[model samples]
Target: MKQLYISFILLSLSFSNSYAYQNKTTKAVDKIVVTKKTQPTKTPIKISNAIIANFVNKYPNLKTYRSDLNNLYLKRNYKSIWFGGKGLIEFANLLYAKTNELEQEGLQSKFAYKNKINSIFTEKTTKNLASVDTELLLSAMYLFYAQKVYKGIESDKIKEIGWLIPQKNLSYATLLSYLLVDPKALDKNDTAQFNQYYKLREVLKKYRKIEQNGGWNKIVRDTLVFELKPGDSSQTIGQIRQRLATTGDLHSDSKSNRYDQELIDGVINFKKRNGYNEDPVITFSQISRMNIPIENYIKTIMVNMERCRWIDPEMTKAAQYIIVNIPSYKLFFVRNGKTELESNVFVGGTMNETVIFSGNINYMVFSPYWNIPTSIVQSEIKTALEQNKNYLVENEMESIKGRVRQKPGPKNPLGKVKFIFPNSNDIYLHGSPSKSLFQSEYRAYSHGCINVNKSEELAYLILKDNTEWPVERIKSAMEGGKEITCMLKEKLPVHMGYFTAWVSDSGEISFFNDIYERDDRLAEILFSEDYN
Candidate 1:
């Protein structure tokens, strides 16, 4: 009976194993096969042809936009589902947003519904197509057009948009584009606009480089030290430090007292060499100079390089010329390619800013007359007339029908001689009795005219070749109190410019205070993304 039971169990086990193996083989066969269906492989997003046609028809000028939309549809039209066709859907949304004819409510609803569609191309489609340069250029062109339209249309809405124009960035972008396209095309002789633009580019390039090199991370700790020669003695240090202290660099502190006298003397010598008054107390300015990043110096040099390129080529070859470096408050006279003379000059006051210009020296007047500007007469003389009826007489001022004038006299604002250049703005070079004003670093104290301290010397130099007048003869002519209108043998060029930073002739970099606050405005525009 046991043997019969064992045989039955063996037979049942064999049957169970066979059944499991058949079931496993059937499952493997099912996994190996891929079944075919009638559905398409790629899905398409839903876009109404009517809506697209209406949009294109409304903006007849947008043929290009419509064409791009058509291309998107043709490339991805295989998909059946609306959301799956990402490119077409995105094109539809952009069209809706950019179209002015679409009702705001309808467009908003469409945008909201379309945004729900998930696809690979969604993010790319929504990106801003306007690049920095393109936007800046467009903004500038629009600004130029808007001004013309603003003049024609008296509507406040038009004027408001015109006023909202980004002028600074636009101007910078336009200048950069011009330079990059044809740098040589910018006249080297026209320093006014060219120099300003060049300087701006330099500053911008420098700031960008600094930002690129991890910004202030590269800053290293440095102590101010006087530049020394290989075999200099230490005795002169204390005196140098004292001089430096007077110039606002050194503080009265225990830490400052620890500075060795040899170090002080070396700093003083460095200051003297670098065009600062010989002072030894190390101040913040000196510290800044010592610690300036290499990138900043590079930018400074580049800024001047651009300036050199922008300088009017005409000035470079002028036989005789006067250059007023606005930042330096100094005038340089070049005769036959040599620097003949230099003197301090007082420029326009803060309220009456000195304008950059270049013109020929047509004539000069001894004991010159002053023609007060119309704006000045209205703003200043009008107020003075109220205070005292004889105000004009007291100041040697006479009134014409609509202008105020000053006669040639001791009390005349125009001291001795005036160099007349026929400019529409009525600006000229002249001498002022307020000689003390020239001593100040911030010498903006004139009425839009340049006042030279050594006018007699300048007059002699300008007229020596043409007038047969030696220095003595020129002095005699001026002392005679006669207005002399001598024609220039060759009309000399005069250039007035503003530069806050420049490289000196000796190759040392120098920085001047931005007395006119012009640098900051320019910097803001140059450093922004749109300007690039």
Candidate 2:
């Protein structure tokens, strides 16, 4: 019994000594951690508004962020943020590491005076020479991080790049306020940041890793001789399989040359991912796109990430709203933050590109007239009318003074119903007489408005709440007849936007072609501009 008691005492002492050593080691990143007595040093590195004012002079490049820095100190009563009674908080390392790896955020922007910040961390003794410069520098970095990662470029510059969507304007003061309460708030998913920005950041990491591993190889194809179809075997088929597997479109690469069902499925997945027709046949154009260097794909992702920065996260927070992705050629109806309906859409062609903007949907017109624009009247319909005097009668179009408008009928181009959202662009969502156009993968044939494939289903979904517009009434309304407008009880928000790369909630990343050719111009501006 005596030996057992002695053993217990020794064991407890050993554990107590080990824990003490570990606790000290954990906080020993800098010299200011603990005093000789091993009690936490309670001295706060005092900062004055004068100190902050002097900082802007030393680092005038951070002039823009002087605001959040000053606000942080004043609210904090000129105390430390990166430090505590213990010394440098552990999150300092985390923030420093993140700032170094900006590419992971799809940002090429550099933090101002990054090397000097690096020296402060590496050479800890230097903190003594300066009065709380380290503290202020870290504060400046947090503001810079928030600005680059969440708020993005200046709003006017985004508009200059042809992006008309609303920019996400963030308050650094609020961020600092949150940070003062909990330093870890900096790492949390910010409510103001467009949620997709994180998803794109995740994909950017994967693609950069792909780039590091020698990237994807280009498939050498003789256009005249190289064509892949089901049951046709070639070495090119194996290359295609490997390529699809790189992006996870294919489950596994059999590493076989045969064009089997597995390869066909991979081809379909690749096509769907790239906004191409889901056909098994592999063409030269598809291979050419595949051959586009992974570097280019990375740039596309970066450009889209910049676009995400310009989007207001709250734009989609309404009870019900619709989002039209022009490049992917699809429309999504979201209710209560869940996607309730998805429809294939055909948007404007290159020459008449659909404007990127948002508006409230207030009404829907059943069997609406196609008021042919004056440009088309002078350029097309007028010429046709001159060619054949009976063209108006043949096409069900009427001449009311100088204007030409097609009457609501079976042959009407506006299809059965058109959803109206008043905007300066004069664009809205509507149906088309030609449903076959929706089947084609390259669905950019419209003039300026969007053509929803499931107009009947959309009408039913939109008015499902109203007892007045039941299924029977909706069916009757869709029937060709005199034009009738049904005003919505509540305005539904709709946003028309452009994105060439998108990451689904399930983590599936899709890369769509830049239909409007806007990416290159935007990329040029972003790469050249100093985020500071």
**After superposition, candidate 2 runs with Cα above 4 Å error:** 1-50, 74-79, 124-129, 179-185, 188-190
Alpha-carbon runs more than 4 Å astray in model 1: 1-300, 400-402, 470-473, 524-532
**Per-residue alpha-carbon lDDT of candidate 2 for residues 319-396, written as tens digits (9 for 90 to 100):** 999999999999999999999899999999989999998889999999899999998898998789789999999999
Number of clashing pairs per prediction, in order: 23, 0
User: Candidate 2 at 452: error in angstroms?
Assistant: 1.4
Relative to the true structure, candidate 1 has a C-alpha RMSD (angstroms) of 19.9
Best-fitting candidate, measured by TM-score? 2
lDDT per residue as tens, model 1, 126-196: 43321221212222222222222111112343223212111211223343234335534322213223333
Per-model lDDT: 0.50, 0.81
Candidate 2, backbone clash total: 0
